[model samples]
Target: MARETWGTRIGFILAAVGSAIGLGNIWRFPFQVSQEGGAAFMVMYLAFIILIGFPAMLAEFVVGRKTELNTVGAIRDFAGGYWQYLGGLFVFIGFVILSYYSVIGGWVLRYILGSVTGGYAATESAAAYFGMVATGTDTLIAHAVFMLLVIGIVALGIQQGIELGVKVMVPAILAIFGILAVYAFTLPGAGEAYAYYLSPDIGYIMQNWQSLVPAAAGQGFFTLSLGMGVMITYASYLGDDKNLGIDGISIVVLNTSVSILTGLVVFPILFSAGVDPATSGPGAIFVSIAEAVLDLPFGRVVGLLFFLTVAIAALSSAISLIEVVVSYAIDEFGMDRVKATVIAGVAIFILGVPVTMNTVFINLYDILAAQILLVLGGVLLMVLVSWLHAGEAIEELEQGIGDLGSIGSLWIWMVRVPVILVLLVSLYLGVTGYIDFLTGAFAEYLGTL
Candidate 1:
């Protein structure tokens, strides 16, 4: 059978954008901004996105569109030899990420239902309410439901499954977010939130650069969906006529816009409620937003829309992550799409069981998948495209964009040197942090013994 291709250029762009915009943008971005000194982290993140993220994205695009294969086959066909194993790492990263990611999606789902029934709004304490639903039997059921939803979408094939779903969900996501942002602007503390969110603190960044750099870089890579073969898988469905450069730019722009918009909605609501945004930690979105909505006149409506937006965004990104492994199975093993999706979905759900049982596992899985694996996968891809297969990669890149000008060489040089250097620094910091965490946990356990 011939491989599936995207229905139109717009469909391809929307699908890629959907993958880029996920929980990382809506759920995690706010806490990261609040913790990293507001605009300081945003400044560093945007710098990395433009400098490293865009270039790394195009490198994956070149590999995918050139070979017209999944990540595993693409690498093996293009570079040959033991390097094929590196593509497997990308697939594993996607699987690992989606495991815990679905748990958060489940939380969003419960919040949506709670909005309609006034279940969560009536609670006396936001933290206590969140604690009740964030883990245990209910969370496990939600995780399974979210995974099933993801599997169903992927089983439908490219045009009907992934493309069509994003075509609707992405537009709805953008529109709902816009509505929320407008509402947030009328809040009492909007001015204070905007100042804090938009103002850069150079002094703080200089002092906290070591820790903040890796955090910002990780967020940049995570939000863009760069390192987990998502871009590669999406690009594989495109024809040579499609301009990879333009598509990549569109994904980055739209994804970043959503991230900023999320901060607009989140920070304003929290500030208006006279709450500290960073103190809530991972539960910030649920706790802060739930409390904000509970006190408003049409609290139920606001809560419903907010959680619905989050659910849609989460679903869109989850589809892409599962598709990475499903595509690999279909291309390499010649498996049916439906069967592949089901098998991959089940395995990922089983892996997520631990995450739902303990919140600590969520943080551990996130650190491993987002901070460590993503940076390593991204840097390897840069090496593969820029150094290992520089000639062919550039040739593939120039196909739809016309003659090779100075910009082509510049992109290549950027990925080869500075991009790799930044990723290596981020990777080093991530590993060191994980080790320190482990050491601290061990010492604490020994004290109890």
Candidate 2:
């Protein structure tokens, strides 16, 4: 059987951008910036996206185009030794992400229901409702339902299903998010939200440079879907019909715009409503933001739109994640996409139970999976492309890159040695103390009352 290619280059770009623009960009990005250093945090995050995220993206393109296999097979065929370990790392990271991501996807479904049902009218009532959703079996059922939707789509195969799915959802997501952002701009205290968001605290970041490094890098990596097999898989479907260089920049721009707009909608509402944006840990994005939205005029209707858009973004991204693991199964085990999808989805569903049942565990899983693995993945990708396969990879990357020589030896080498070690050490600290610091604060907040 031959591998599937995307129907159109535009369809492929939209799907790739959809995969990149997930709830992490919306909820996670804003909250992380607020916690790290606000405007200063945004500066670092943007910098990393350009430096690390863009190159890693081209590297994945090199691997996918060269091997025409999924992550597992790519590494196995390419390195022929420990290279397959890289692919295994890809599979592992995707599986871990799916476990918790679908749980949040469920929350999106619940909020979708609320939009129609007026789920949150009064500020106080909205807070209580959020608590119920966060700590309820309701979330479990929603997670299962969302996972099923993802599996059903992947079961339809890549061209007939995944590409078509993103083509529809990505546009709707943008439309709805645009409407919500317009509405947000009209709200009382929206200006304060803008002020709170735009005002960069350089002093805070300078004093806390240690914490900002990994926080900004990890968030940047996850936001662009770099340092993951998603980019590799998306690139594997690419044809030479379009300029890879131009399309790569477009995807990054679209993803970054949605993330920035998400902040526009969220932080303003939080500042106006007096809810601490950082109060809920990683979960804070949903819980705290929902609480703030409940206080706006016709707040329930707004909450409905917010969560519904969130659900769409989450589901779209979740599909790519499941595909990453399932593609490995199909590529290596000869399992059909349907069986592969079911096997991976069901397995992750069971593993996700811990995160679902225990809110604390769910938060911990979100932090560690993203903070440690994401940065680690990005660093390794930089080393591999910038050095391990530099001579060959750069050639492939530069085919349409215009001038390959401009990247310079020192420039590429920078990502290979110092940059790699820095991200690795950041990963180590993020997995240990930082987890305790962030989660512990979150747990303390949850424990109150």
Could you say which candidate leads in TM-score?
1
Residue 68 lDDT in candidate 2: 72
Model 1 misses residue 435 by how many Å?
A: 1.5
Q: Which residues of candidate 2, in runs, are more than 4 Å off?
A: 122-124, 400-403, 408-411, 417-422, 432-449
Q: What is the C-alpha lDDT of each candidate?
A: 0.90, 0.77
For model 1, residues 6-121, the per-residue Cα lDDT tens digits are: 99999999998998898889988888897788988889999999999999999999999988999899989989998898899999999999999999999999999888888786
TM-scores for all candidates: the values are: 0.98, 0.92
lDDT of 2: 0.77
Identify the runs in model 1 with alpha carbons over 4 angstroms from their true place. Answer: 444-449
lDDT per residue (tens digit) for residues 1-449 in model 2: 88888888888788888888887787678778778767778777777777666656766777776677898887676567776787888888888888888887887787777667666443356557667666557778888998999999889988888988999889988998899889879877788777667777788778876778778778877877766688887777776545666787888889988988888888777877887765646567767766776667777777878887888888788888888898889888999888899999999888887777777776566666677877777776677777777787766665555565766455467667766776786688677755676877778888995
Error of 2 at 422 (Å): 4.5
lDDT for model 1 comes to 0.90
Q: What is the lDDT of residue 360 in candidate 1?
A: 75
Quote the positional error of residue 243 for candidate 1 in Å. Answer: 0.9
